[model samples]
Target: MGALKFKFLFAFVLVFIVAIGSANIAEFDEVWQQRAAMAEKDAEAAYDPYPEQSRNRAVEGRNSTRRSLRGYKGACVATNPIDRCWRCRRDWARNRKRLADCVLGFGRKTTGGKYGRYYVVTDPSDNDMLNPKPGTLRHAVIQPEPLWIIFKGPMVIKLNEELIMTSHKTIDGRGAQVHITGGAGFTLQFVSNIIIHGIYIHDIQQGSGGLIRDSVDHYGFRTMSDGDGISLFGATNVWLDHLSMRNCHDGLIDAIQGSTAITISNCHFTKHNEVMLFGASDSYPKDSIMQITVAFNHFGQGLVQRMPRCRYGFVHVVNNDYTHWLMYAIGGSQHPTIISQGNRFIAPHNLFAKEVTKRDYAPMSVWKNWLWRSENDLMMNGAFFVKSGDPKRMAEFTAKDVITAKPGSYVPRLTRFSGALHCTINKPC
Candidate 1:
């Protein structure tokens, strides 16, 4: 046999072996089929948050409301149509639940407080974390059944401990100034179907975690928390929107330990060391099934690292305006699949941290097969993304057909309303 023919045969055998390995890898196209199976089992659940006529229009079942937010009560034309969809109406404060219809992303399946009656919070106190008082934020969060919680007035609450939230709840802060600050923050653990919107959460301190009330009927001992603005542990189907968060002791948001079907949209995060973290660690195999959508947010001002550091999951970061960063931006480990689409990243003037990506806990020799990709991303002012992953496998991602993200230049328009919004009555917000 010719030497060239022998080399060709050897290459073919190597390709076959690697193809088999791709079948078992966590950060690849195979996980899309896994998510589809989960969706099939929960088919009875309805996407009824949207009007029947406008269901499942685009990627991630997003049916965007293309309503123009201009010309209502002399309101200026808005850039983000999603933020304008509900608040543009004259009767916004009256029909507050309509904000549920405005959500557009992967966690859009969340129907939080959709089936519950409204509960108004008149008190601003968090006197006790273990024994909550009625009419307080703590009391509302500890309720067992579904609730649409709203604030009656402007108030700043300093929590004594973690505000442990129950399942099937919505803490909607429309028409009021609500701030959860100066102390420990939220702990969302082992729950599902929750929505947190239009609030300011910042300046968090770590908790000496002990017995905390999660629900009216359930109170359990908790270990010390890491002081994240929002900590999601083993949670699913959660949505966070229109929040202004900064200066937390740990990450601004940490979704770990099998948290799936989550979305973080239109939130402003600033002045933090570690920013967002997805999946817990590479050792947790269950986290391989996690999937999250992060879209239409602003990673602005005083961020050190980890725009999101992932481990064993599929995370889509799309259409975000990143105006500042002290260190590198996106990162991953444990072969997590990251699809960065249409984000504007402006690196700090520092030369050492100009790269926008980092792969932790793995060397290139072993991590090259991980499926990390960047599409239509705008890196400006010397910013760059060091991409790694299987290019062929990334192209085959099934979620690509469900939701097509806009380009990075559109980040400015998408993240126009990137924090807690104060919508004036009879005015488009």
Candidate 2:
């Protein structure tokens, strides 16, 4: 009887232990299933249907946050305002404000508003007039008429003809578009404080021997012809903004003959021999100290070689994006003191395969020009193609210093207009 009681007690204890273990296992399985279901629900919530207003609000919140971090104002942010509205104007205002603070801090040094007088040129809307007279130098002034001559409509001016510019006058564009056709070019001789804005200039072929074509097949380097989209001569305090030029023999923009305090911004240059030409003849020693700023521009496509040639001067090439080029995206002069910063150069293959050999004339100084190679870009050309005496400094460039834009990308705010004071003209011709 004692042995039977002990066996029964042992069996009862073993059964009780198994029951407790089974209950614990069942509880763990239930908890795990609950957690999995909660995770799935959260994922589903991520795709919840929201109204357009809510979506916009979320985006605006994100943009606001980013703007706050960068100390930037999103006042001019819009979608494609150039066609319907003056978007570039708005951006120009914002940029001017940002630069004004910096310029004031630098003590507002007076750089002789040599191109001071401003003028407006237009064609006659009526058939009564054909050959419109160019404005005179004496009439161009900062006071009274303020050198604002309104051209009637889009027309072409003949070459070798003089358009005398007086001091402190800026040639502001009317709402109407102006096109300068034929092989003629405007010569700005001894002008100061001039601003040419919102113009489309094309097809002004340079005179004989003005452009040289290379046998090589580079995009921007090989020039079939020579005529700059715009040329500046002996001009100071000049601003060339919101302009587009394509398919010229020489350069899209050319600055020669001692042009100083020049700013070329928010412009597009495509399908040209050279995107920009700084110095043709450094005959004038003062031209050697060319102080120009080329910024916020898009240059690409159909360009074969030598995007820019900077000879004998100080230049700040910043915040411009180059899509594709054949060779030597930018070539510097043997002269030093050139700052090439905040620019993006994109070439998948050996875009700049032909290295520029250092000329014996002078020691060229090139620092911080960014070069990019895409995964799809293969180097079929030889590796040692680039010929620069100072190749050691070239390897130090990184993506952080370059301003690169993706292909087919554009910033609409770049061309928007923000504020303008409209003044009425009482006297008419």
Candidate 3:
């Protein structure tokens, strides 16, 4: 009888551990649900944000909005909704915190350091890992309080180790040209509300294992870094916008381990393979809660595949220009739900890679049931998307989760200023 009781207790403990593990992995489900609610409001707004650009006509699903070009005068033409939020303003430097309210899509709630004071990064050195200089970018990101981090001048920071970040921080490289290259990359591990904008992250090499300060009160030994430009592990409410990224040793951006409520927008990606990876492993079932938005970015030349390769998540690819791709543009496995809307796919001359979508590690019998839909996307040069799954399953989605297509022709106008802009102090960005 005692032996039987021991076996029952062991079974109960195993069940409890599994339950706790599942809950821990999906800790950001509330964030994901909130973004989905925001997506509904985004659909009804018809891309109208600025009062000056309010004349743009609202249309039905999959129709183009008539943009009013009358009163808009300047070199700053904010075509997309995200750009219209904060661009074309002369006092952007002073009102830098306003950008925290401009984020859209799954990362709509990411208000990185909007409430905090500004911290100017005067030094571009990463000589120390344990005790960072006060005026350095490393120190600004590690502070306990929220901070709007800006650069003093244009500089290149080749990191000595992976720049592990804390929550509620914005690396706003607007007034200056900042470059992170030739060394380790940024790591967002178990944090929230981070905005990395207007910087160039490329040529990232792996960092060796060492003791690093991740937060104001924490110092821990970190393993050798993967050479991704930005690696998000169990992070939420993150926005990556208006950055130029290329030629990383591994992926340019990778979000895994149940990271959600993220958006990658208004960026230019070139000369990279495995550009973005949303989910890490097939065995990580917790990754099913991952949700990301890829919008208004220019996927330019020298990109082979995986403009984003996804797994076990819901990805919204909207209003991006895929101008060049040597291989297939989007690939997925492990039953990810990919909604491709209002994107332009200009396929390479290679006929074998004309298809925009590629399914991996599964036969047609298995992957055919995955929800992959291409709505109002311009399939140029014989590019095609193999759509699957039941269309009626969309009825199960909430209003916020529903996306109406804006037509692919608007991609050029939406993603016109895709890369990091050279913004003058009193001029529009």
Candidate 4:
């Protein structure tokens, strides 16, 4: 009789577990569909049909000699629409808050600290992890109120531990040369509306875990960091722009565990393997909501692979200059939708690594149906992109071609000022 009871209980528990699993799968599917729709909408909204037409018309009116005499410095040259929005202004310092309104792509809604007062970082020291000084960058980011953080001068801050950030903050390193190196990197975990711009983040090391203040009201024990230059764990509405990154212990930038609505733009990356990873785990179906836009960045020398590698997400890689790569440029697994539009891919001299895209843990029969498209991409040095999926599906994913881009041949001119700019007080950035 006892044996019979045990068998009946086992059957009941199995049914209950199956029911819960089915319900969770249904929830995951629902969230994925919603986020995918939102991503498509954001991508479409960020498109500009003709950014260079006006400039080209003006150049045509002027003679070559006159144009040459004008020079590159006198003219405020803004290539892409994102740069044109703010980089053309001479009084950018006077109106520093205007940059908060200029974010494009999936992170367009990120108005980081736009409504808040400026918090200038006068100190570059990170002596205290739990109780940071008032004039330090750590203090500026952990405040409960919004703040537009900026540096007073050129400085290098080697953090003693992982610098945790709060919501509604902007670290604008426009006028000053700011470098965060030889230590741990920034951590944006479960935060939103953050903009990290114009900072050099490289040579990072893993942090030994201890008590760290993450916010104004929260101080908690933490674990050792992965040593990424910028690590995003469950973060949203974040934009990283005009930064130079390389030679980190782990990835240059990593967004994982349900992080979404991010844009990495106008940055320069070099001398790094596993440059960027969008989704970390294949089993994390919650990452289906992850969406990112990589635009106008220069992938320079001594790079290996994953610029970036994605999984279970939508990534729009548009108008970037890939000058060098030892391994494959872009890679993925678990059926991520990657739209490569008008990007310049110059493969290395190595004949074995000529393919721009790499797929893992999937056979041709399965991965051939994944939505990966290359539209107007310029491939050089015998480089090629192995595209898959149906044309109709590609059209649908692109929202009827609302997200248009310039041809990849224009990449050099578009990405001319890719990295952090040296802006004078009253000059255009």
Evaluation by lDDT, superior candidate among 2 and 4: 4
Q: For each candidate, what is the lDDT? A: 0.75, 0.41, 0.80, 0.80
Worst lDDT run of 10 residues, candidate 4, spans: 57-66
Tens-digit lDDT track of model 1 for 343-406: 8888889999889888888788878888788888888899888777667765554442124567
**What is the TM-score of candidate 3?**
0.83
Residue 19 local lDDT, model 3: 47
lDDT of 2 by residue, 179-229 (tens): 554553344434455555555666666533221111111001111223555
Candidate 1 to truth, TM: 0.82
Between candidates 2 and 4, which one is better according to TM-score? Answer: 4
For residue 317, model 2's alpha carbon misses the true position, in angstroms, by 0.6
Q: Per-residue CA lDDT of candidate 3, range 1-429, in tens? A: 999999999998677656444222222245434533553333223221221221222212323333232243557877777778799999988899889987777777789999899999999999889999999989989999999999999999999888988778999999799999999999887678899999999999988857787777766655567788999877888899999999998899999877888889989999998899989888887777777879888999899999899999888898888988888899999999888888999889998999999999999999999999888788888999999999786544332322344789777777777878778798887
lDDT over C-alpha atoms for residue 323 of model 4: 87
What lDDT, from 0 to 1, does candidate 4 have? 0.80
Candidate 1 lDDT score at position 276? 91
User: Can you give the TM-score per candidate against the true fold?
Assistant: 0.82, 0.51, 0.83, 0.83
Which regions of candidate 3 are displaced past 4 Å? 1-74, 395-398, 401-403
**Reference-based TM-score, model 2:** 0.51
Indicate the residue-level lDDT of 138 in model 2.
21
